[model samples]
Target: MANTKKDILTILGISIKPGESKEVNFDVANLHTSTPVNVPVIIERSKKPGPTVLFTAGIHGDEVNGVEIVRQIIAKGINKPKCGTTICIPVINVFGFINLKREFPDGRDLNRVFPGSSNGSLASRVAHKLIHEIIPHVDYIMDFHTGGSGRFNAPQIRIVEGERELNDLAKVFGAPFVLYSKHLNKSFRNTCAKLGKVMLLFEGGKSFHIDDLITNSGVNGVKRVLNHLDMLSSKFKVSVPKKDCILIKKSKWKRAKYSGMFKASATISSKVLKGDILGNITDPYGKFNYFVKADNSGYIINVNEAPIVYQGDALFHISTKLED
Candidate 1:
């Protein structure tokens, strides 16, 4: 017979026997004030043996939607594991999180420094620890994210490249849409793919703010994925046939033409044709106005929610398809 205890206690480098949940902390950085910051990880092991699934959020400190999603999932409770374990890391960037910023204090984007070296910059060291220690023990990984500050994104799963299995998994997660995205070098998803792991990126809402709709969608999506993996019992039935996801072979960012107050005529997820008027940038006196237009036909996946903008700042992101 196997042990059936649900909650166990342990720290990093120490392993508890099967059938328990343990909280572990990995040291990320030490502040000038002598306070050490750590990444908190929760490991939930099932009574029955199975595959280990890792759920990570807040890689960008400002992205709160993912953090909330992970929290809600853990709060709901996991019963008997159908197969193995579930590891949840709610926040990955402790430093950035503390400051409510997206990048590290050194101004480095942590997501772009993946699979890093131990003896590198602060961000690189943190990335290295995640890549080397946490990622290796997991089978499947889900990294949650949101649009950066002042931007809004529709709830979507970004499946890297054309991996059919990942696409299927994203569909199961039941986001409004799945974005078939090309993987970027040094991204967490790309690093995992290189290691032969299936990774799904969930992006939604705006950073540092809580949108209930996006949060609920994300919570339900994670649960759906767990059910699909047979890690959780399936009790709820999906109401709609899975939506056919749009394949974003490539994406383009529309930048502000000039510094001023801005207004957008459309929201994220809206479809537009080439030369369609999207918004306008106007000076304080309204004397100078610049119109922003879509350059091609595509769906808007990201839009600036803030009304103010500076010249050359990204205002919208559209994904387009090329003619054969």
Candidate 2:
């Protein structure tokens, strides 16, 4: 499996009143020249009281599908939802975002340091600021992501194993599949869960590029989850049909055997049986090619398209559910 409702929203020293909405830019960091960097947040309080849902995107900076998904949500307006408040932070790592990198300029992955120390590295400080100000107030969170550069991901929801409610929400998301994964230490997903908060991570498309196929599906999934949880007054047209959501317990990644160009035989979401040739890795001149066979039957959730590759480079991500 892979992985919201509303509340009174307050952050950046601003307190939002019930039945109202406000957008605030939070000053969290500074430049060497004393320039201030701000995180943009939109808080909409429902007329009726309920749980709060935190929608976070751009944590990796390069991943923009989440950014677009959140942007459209704010643009479309889910104000005065049936209950609770929707707090949207379209971009968290402002530094990485402008740099188009996943880590801070000082070189730290923000996602790896959670409930961060107040007086730590730049990444830690930023993580601390966000966790202290945001995570505690929310009942549930949706962290968005996309494949790293040069990789394409099949739209899917990944959640930590064994949370019944979270599992249900993942289904409501209606992605092509659901992946149950173990939590990464200090990651937003793990930290939130450690604090007893329910969260989901949505991964799709490729980083940096705007893949509308992922963006649209993400928007609809978020809305569908909101409606399913009774946080929204309306139901969204779930992009993927309910019947299409396949639940998977595990996945495997296939790596390139030799440095060369990769010609893939399977696209994202295409299923293949074990021993099938998922792709071929060959030299630039096509002098010789090695068949990258499928180790397990499953859908090809991710693939690399870069013309050049180094040995051991991940060429495919297989999402599989083994036979019972």
Candidate 3:
């Protein structure tokens, strides 16, 4: 007979046996008002042990779309995996989520304070707890994100370009594009890489709001990934992105030439050529209007949403990988 006994998975002092789904609260810190803040976690362990996958969101409290994506997956179709385990943390920064901000109450960027220390600041301590306690157990990770304040991003996956494993997973995630960006200092992505876990980041829509297109793509992407890992039921048909996902190796931002009221001429996913007028910053009194033209031909992945802009403000994130 085969050995059915599997290694126990414990998080926040709570043990989840195989074929179990547990919802638990992980106490991280307290507010100035003495309100206890906790990270809500959901774990699903399969009867057949395999890879442990982590799905995290809400590192920035104001980014609500990611939270919705998690809810979509759980409420719509995702159940216990057929093999391995799945852990989902819809909100990681409870303090920031409470205040609708990106940073912790102590004004620290939670995403930038990874590998946290137990004896450090609130963000640092939370990071420490996550890095040491949660991350070490997971073999794969997907951290969801969205456009920052006053910015908007098309549904996309951002991964470290040269990492084949992660890049392959990103392709399986299947967004409009696979974007390569510089790794941030002390970010969870960097920390996970150092620990030898395959992690990728997904971005879509804008902060504080939801777009059906972006949200649907996100939920479907997660399902596809699970299917690829053979964690889903055989009866389930995997999904693909609405369009072919382009691989963007090189991208640049077009900046405003003059400080004024800004307007965009092209939206996300639109293809533009060199010298295309993407947007303009006009003088308040309408005396002068400056056109922000693309320096090179590319696809628009992100667009600035703010009405006002200063010279050199980034207006569009364009990828040179166009055609097909």
Candidate 4:
């Protein structure tokens, strides 16, 4: 991760000196009812100067699991670093959050618009503000997310392949898995990369659901990263990850063969061999039962948790390759 040093930090025109804290509003626009929405940006600085880290979540409104993780980081005072600055934006897409929807009110996916125009759509303006105002002052970013809908993902840190700095930081984050993925076009990660910012995108759990295990993984991983940077407070103790972090080079999704009620017997992050029974699809009248088998021997990273499925719906995401 990159590090920037300065005696004073100014964000959104607010000048914050060392050992100061402030809550600034990332004001985008008001609701349809003319209510002013407050997207609070919590900033904490230590007496000593160090790197500036930005922690953000809820870019996709329904990804409450990610929001919970950031909330815990702030609630537990983990954002109060012993050195440097910590900025927390627990809910970036507050518009979507209020409506319990995934996209902006204008039906735009916030993550798809990056380095946005100031006079574009609502989502674009928000994106433009974030990239132009907040990102410039930050050296490192940790954005949190979860599976879109029914698919439950194991805790993992995702980064583009072949970057030693990202790989080293991902290892320090200490998540259960580190998946090498390419950056999506116009994504926040891609924009940050273009701006020479180091970011670790965290994915886990499912949208609109909060899992304690997943929450702990994210919070702990943040602590580990802060500790590695020598910014963690002395009051908190960092725990070693329970398992070795697996590096996945390639993966494949197992789709359903028959359209029926589905149930997964295989759990996330478990290893399975070819031809192993992973789950089953059954008819409503109990007239038929079809067992879903693994096509290859690999680790299961994501399992669809929805009760119903179509024939082509994805059932399980399994790793097909690993990094040595």
- Model 1 worst lDDT run, 10 consecutive residues: 1-10
Whole-model lDDT values for every prediction: 0.80, 0.81, 0.84, 0.94
TM-score of model 3 vs. true structure: 0.94
What is the per-residue lDDT of model 4 for residues 3-50, given as tens digits with 9 covering 90 to 100? 345477788888888898999989999999899999999999998778
Q: What TM-score fits each model? A: 0.88, 0.93, 0.94, 0.98
Residue-pair clashes, model 1? 4
lDDT of 1 by residue, 160-180 (tens): 666789878887888877777
Among all windows of 10 consecutive residues in model 4, the one with the lowest summed lDDT is: 1-10
- For residues 243-267, what per-residue lDDT tens digits would candidate 2 score against the true structure? 6587778788888888887788788
Ranking by TM-score: 4, 3, 2, 1
- Candidate 3 per-residue lDDT, tens place, 42-114, comes to 8988889788888889999899999999877777647468888888888998889888998998899998888
Clashes of 3: 1
Runs of candidate 3 exceeding 4 Å displacement: 1-5, 234-236, 321-324
Clashes of each: 4, 16, 1, 0
3 or 4: which has the higher TM-score? 4
Which stretches of model 4 miss by more than 4 angstroms? 1-6
